[model samples]
Target: MRLSKLFKNAPTTNVTGLCFDSRKVQPGNVYFCLPGMTHDGHEFIKQAVEKGAICIVHSKELKPEEMPVGAIYIRVADTVDAMNQAARIFYSKPSDKMLMYGITGTNGKSTIANVIRNIRNKKEPTGYIGTIAIEYGNVRLQPDLTTPDALFLQEKLSEMVRHGMKACALEVSSHGLAQRRVDGINFDVAIFTNLTYDHLDYHGTMKSYFEAKSLLFSERVKPTGKSILNIDDACFEKLQRISQAPVITYGIEHECDYRAINVQILPKQSKFDLVYQGKTYPVVTNLVATYNVYNLLAAIAALHETDMDLDVILEACKNLPQVDGRLEQIDMGQPFHVIVDFAHTPDGMKKMFQFGRQIAQTHKLISVFGSAGKRDVAKRKVFGELADQYCDYIILTEDDPRDEDPAVIADQIEEGIESSNHVFIEDRYEAIRQAIESANPGDCVLLLGKGDEPYIYRENGRAPYKGDNVIAKECISKYCRHINEAVDDVNEDESFIEE
Candidate 1:
């Protein structure tokens, strides 16, 4: 495809490749000047031109004097939108060729996307783009952002097409929506998991946050897409009214297009009756937590809208396993249970605790958690308060302190703990060890906050670190032998007492 054809209304220009990074610019490439939070792409215009960029597309107004002598400079109201459009044309609109289902909301987006991608057989060659990673066929790319830039997104979609993928499940973040990163992709189905107070630092208010998410279902973006929503969410009623696409509702509380009835949240698993189109499907999922039932229902509704056979969907659900870092369980033959969860938000933390309480019968629930620094300070106390109410014991530790003092963040969480059952520990590894040492045969320890994150963000820089799953496994193995020895010692003491 010619570069001239890619620019809908802009002047015709010859280009060889497309790029946003100045360092990657080459002769005949069109350099998209993007404006980011920290740096403006316009600042690198000279570098792009010097590197032999054929044309420039920028969000800001450009004066004739600012343009390179021979280089073409096109100014648009939004460079991000323009880049998305150009990418669509360059990639021949790959999203339209494959069935694309986009999952958006504050939470469950990644989990739902992963579950859907996992259940789909390899025969169709499904691709996934989300917080975890991007998978095209058998190839995988580690994800640096929840959603990549428009140009990169289009490139990935095109690659998926080349690999003969029949479907793609993408986790669309509000940041991606607000920035117009996924502006031109045509989604066959759009999913709304649930909207809660999150990313307020960027969005400013809950209303703004919802609006950013609403952009995904707007007529301009996804006019022909089917909207699968959680009707039980308070924001759904208003969103349903405004959404331009056909709506499909899924939930547990109220009647929806897809509903789960007689849902039982067990410690190790959950069982529910899935009702869709008046037909019932029994589901026994190893993906624990009542919250996951809603996620599973959302995925089912999306798959159903794709016209997949109900039996196929059910089979997929039954075989679907837990997503990594999302409520993953680690067992080392210890009498007690251990779980690692990516519950960063207050709502997520509360839900995990609720599930923990339900499954922790005849056992104590011990929780170890921390808050992310330089983000969402308001939720620190909320996490503490919930941890206090739910867990038998709570340890407030370090998450990603970023540039802030880890101790200060721990104190912020400590403020919400009204119960005397909680302890504050700034060292995360020590906290995990302490929790393990304190646990008895019937106690369950939960490591929360970090999830699958593989690094610790500190003031200096990000340091390589093992994920919660790894740490949990090590802690369990180290403590299980000690637990057995202690048990033997206790038995001998009891025998002497009896004698």
Candidate 2:
């Protein structure tokens, strides 16, 4: 546990635990001066020194006079990389203790991670770290980042190993990869969901975005890991060429190592024949949407590569419940149906609307959706165009108008809609009410955006907000009770007429 042992080439006279935040520094902790996008870690070096930091690891070159007395000063090319190395060494490289799966893509990362976690069974104590809460054994910790910093990630993995978890699935974001947040972890399996036009603001271009995502399969990852890829994706052909480990491909379009044949896409669920190694296994998933077919195959491929039996995989998937805010259905004795989903991206929105249209038998498909302000403005019009194509009625509303005018965002979306029948409501609650009140018997109301987001970001500050799934259930219960009372009154009038 000596500081010298943790830092191989650098001087480490005094060291304890490593931390990125200055406020969290302790008497013996080594504070890493990481320059973040919003704030500079170098600015807080004095505060860290005041808190009794024993060492300072920084990316910038500094004179000896700037160093605190009795504190070791080490300079690296990048502070993030230095922190990753220090954490990996400090935690004894915990990722090597168990089977670790890294899933990276623009969409479907959380859903795929959850599906794989569910299939692994609760008996083995599987953990998941992603956009949702991080689970270590029975303990759940809320996640502030899609992938936490290297120090926290290593610490969490260490805790998972200490808790005796046999497996862990993590969602690796593009930003996380670019920042070297997951630099030192050894992965047993790497998965790539489909890539699309997303996170262009940070990446600068689509090619750069994909390059950031491809880092998961780079040489820096564990050599023994296996790559599970969706071969049907256009980018997969190129990605397969660069992958360093053994590759396993899955798709419904072509003959892959694992394939889904005899597929039946249903209104409530989907049934498919999972063909692998020249044997076909029947799988019935409780999840809805055709896109889920891809998600399920990715999970199956990951498990199969680990030598999991097809029977166990099928049985586990059959009993798997729906994930929160991902195509969650709400029923409250209402004549119509309601679904809440987190389909913020253009491709995700189109897929959700298509699924809604398919299931809306003898009903009007009413969709309530809005574009996020100040992020990915290019996708706003695409979402609006898709809604117009598949929805009978469109209700445009607020979705995190962060520092931008909600009305302006709505207008941009409106510009893409060819139909003149859409209603624009800036207030999200009013939009939900308008959609619900307009629904009659044999109608389906679809709520999109802010699926499981706990807060709504605004110019002033964020306000506590419940998930759309919760709000949809409450609206359905209130409306159904009113409908029941109205039916009772109508029946009484009928009795008087009979008399």
| TM-scores vs. true structure, each candidate | 0.92, 0.93
Clashes per model (N, Cα, C within 3 A)? 0, 0
RMSD of 1: 4.9
- Per-residue lDDT of model 1, residues 14-63, tens digit only: 67888899999999899999877899899888899999998888878777
Evaluate residue 478 in candidate 1 and report its C-alpha lDDT on the 0 to 100 scale: 75
Pairs with steric clashes in candidate 1: none
Model 1, TM vs. native: 0.92
Cα lDDT listed for each candidate: 0.82, 0.82
TM-score of 2: 0.93
Which residue pairs clash in candidate 2?
none
